[model samples]
Target: MSVGLGLPIAAPEQLPTWARRADASPFSTLALLDRLVYANPEPLVTLATLVGTTERVRLQTEVLLAPLHRTALLAKQAATLDLLSGGRFTLGIGIGGRPDDYLAAGIEQRTRGRRLDDQMARMRRMWNGQPLGDEVGPVGPAPARPGGPEVLFGGFVPAVMNRVARWGDGFLGAALPPAHMDRLFRDVEAAWAKQGRAGRPRLVAQVNAALGPEETVAAARREAHAYYHPSPFADHVAEGILTTPRAVRDAVAAFRAIGADEVMLYCWAPDPEQVERMADAVF
Candidate 1:
């Protein structure tokens, strides 16, 4: 089973030791992205540095909201990162949940789904080095990989799932229920068949995990709420689905059985040492 780790680009004070321990172990990949656009210090530059220093680790954005920025600019930024990382970048994208983000960007959040679909198309064209409007032959300094890096779409809404099947290379399912995940995969496969695309859709699942003494479960729950309250699966926290390491591992196994290609463990601990301990427990 291939497993990955996801880290949030939040306050420096919020990064646990585990988040900082990029030097150890061999997980499938490391996904990094900020929840709030302006909260982090130079997100693109920081991500580039991480890619430059780390070998054999795939770098990804849990999701870089496209509607919040110009499609051309986003493509350029992603292409640069992909080039710097030797094609190690996987551009995970989505329409953001925060209305405030759109307001801050002076963009409206209406019709975000369709807008995202259009943006995806535009991004692919840009990455292919195709010039927009009235430009030269092709965009210079193409991404290290041909056709640019792989794109993973995030969100579990039915419309989002359909879009993933129609366009994205894969689906980044946020804490989805097991049964719904199965249905989503079926839809993706059906869409692929209808489009005459070969092979199955790549599915990535993210689960919140905390492993430690029983006394720590409450803290973990609070941390999870802080991070995932905006997501669809926020209610699962009370159901005891994401309270322990054992539970998280079982959930990963369950997702695998339901056709998930990879599971990215999202840890909630602010303590770096605890995060490392949890990684030891699962990885």
Candidate 2:
């Protein structure tokens, strides 16, 4: 399985250097997290900048909240990124759990799931170059990939399976243990079979790691807790962070053994050196 790195939502000024480091590292992809009411750079914007800076690593949104934006616009943005990135992009989307983000985006919280479903359907049509009837031909600058960048769906419930079956190319499993990941993958595979999808959907998984001295690892735990503790799985997330090289090594092996196509190790600390630490541990 290929190993990838997730660029943390840190100071914007530091991102260029971080992106360069991740690109140069022995990693397969550079992923980003999305949030409207948080500290992260807008995933697409940050990714656009990296399109010119990084030559090899694939880019992903990690999980862009689709319900917050207009469907066609999001589709266009994704296609543009794919075009500019030489087809090295993946659109990972989900109906995120933060109601505050929805409120901030002027979206209705209760209808997000339905909204995401509709958005995915629309995006696929847009990517396929279908006409909108009122528009002047299909959306232009067709995706770098024929059908558009691969779409990966992420969420915490079985409802997500429906979207995966319809539009996604894979399942973007969250930061979870190998046992839980096993169950999640099985469910997604079952969903794909039930929907009669052509082949097995790709299986990608994520885990948080803070590889450095005690101080950096501690900060990683704090950041992980601050971001995840608002949910019901706070303790599980907090406890899952890999603090040592051995921890990172073990976690990667565990996820790969469970059949993950790629396992992304998200850095919780904002330090650029964290990339090297991770590379040292994994590469």
Candidate 3:
């Protein structure tokens, strides 16, 4: 399986260094997280900043809350990023599970899934040279790839299966155990077949990791807890932290064995040293 590196969202200023290091290292992809009401930098904009700086690493939003943005605007932004990146971009999108984010975006969370469905349809049309019932054609430059950037869907709901089967190029299994990844991936595969999709969806899983001195590890855990606060997910994430070289190796092995196409090490520690530490642990 290909190994990828997630952005150290805890240290936004250091990302360019991390991005260059990840690209030059063994990491095949550079992933970023999105949150409007949080510390993580805005993913697409940050990623765009790296386009000329790195050549080979694929960029992903990890999971952009699709329902929070206007459909046409998102379609254009995504296409522009893909075009500039030489097609090294993936749009990992979802109906995010935070109510405060919804309130901040001034968008309701209750109908997010349905809105994403509509957004996907309209965005596809826009990418393929059709406007959203307007006078002009194509919203922006065509993506470097034929369609728009490959899209991956994220989230834990069964509704996600429908979205993947219908529109996603893959499933983004975020920070789940291999066992859970296996089951959800299988469910996605079954849905894909049921819907008569020509090929199976790509399976990309993530694991939160912090490999270094005790201080870095502790800080990573604290950051993780703060980000996933109040949700049972924080506890789940805590339980799954890979803090040692052996633990990181084992986690990657488990996901690879479970058929993940790629596994991104989601670093909680902001230290750029982690770029080499994680690479050393993995390969």
Q: Please tell me which model should have the higher lDDT, number 2 or number 3.
A: 3
Cα lDDT computed for each candidate against the true fold:
0.70, 0.87, 0.89
Top-TM-score structure, candidate number: 3
lDDT of 1 by residue, 133-238 (tens): 6754555569988887888888766777677777778888766667777887777777767777777778888876655666455565765565556667665763
What is the C-alpha lDDT profile of model 3 across 84-179, one tens digit per residue? 999998999988888999999999899888899999999998888776675766687788888789999998778898889989898999877899
Question: Cα lDDT of model 2 overall?
Answer: 0.87
For candidate 3, the lDDT comes to: 0.89
lDDT of 2 by residue, 134-170 (tens): 7546875689998889999997699887778878899
Candidates sorted on TM-score, descending: 3, 2, 1
Task: List candidate 1 stretches off by more than 4 Å.
Answer: 8-23, 37-45, 213-219, 228-243
Better of 2 and 3 by TM-score: 3
Please rank every candidate by lDDT, starting with the best.
Answer: 3, 2, 1
Q: Point out the higher-scoring one by TM-score: 1 or 2.
A: 2
Each prediction's TM-score versus the true structure: 0.85, 0.95, 0.97
Model 2 clashes, total count: 0
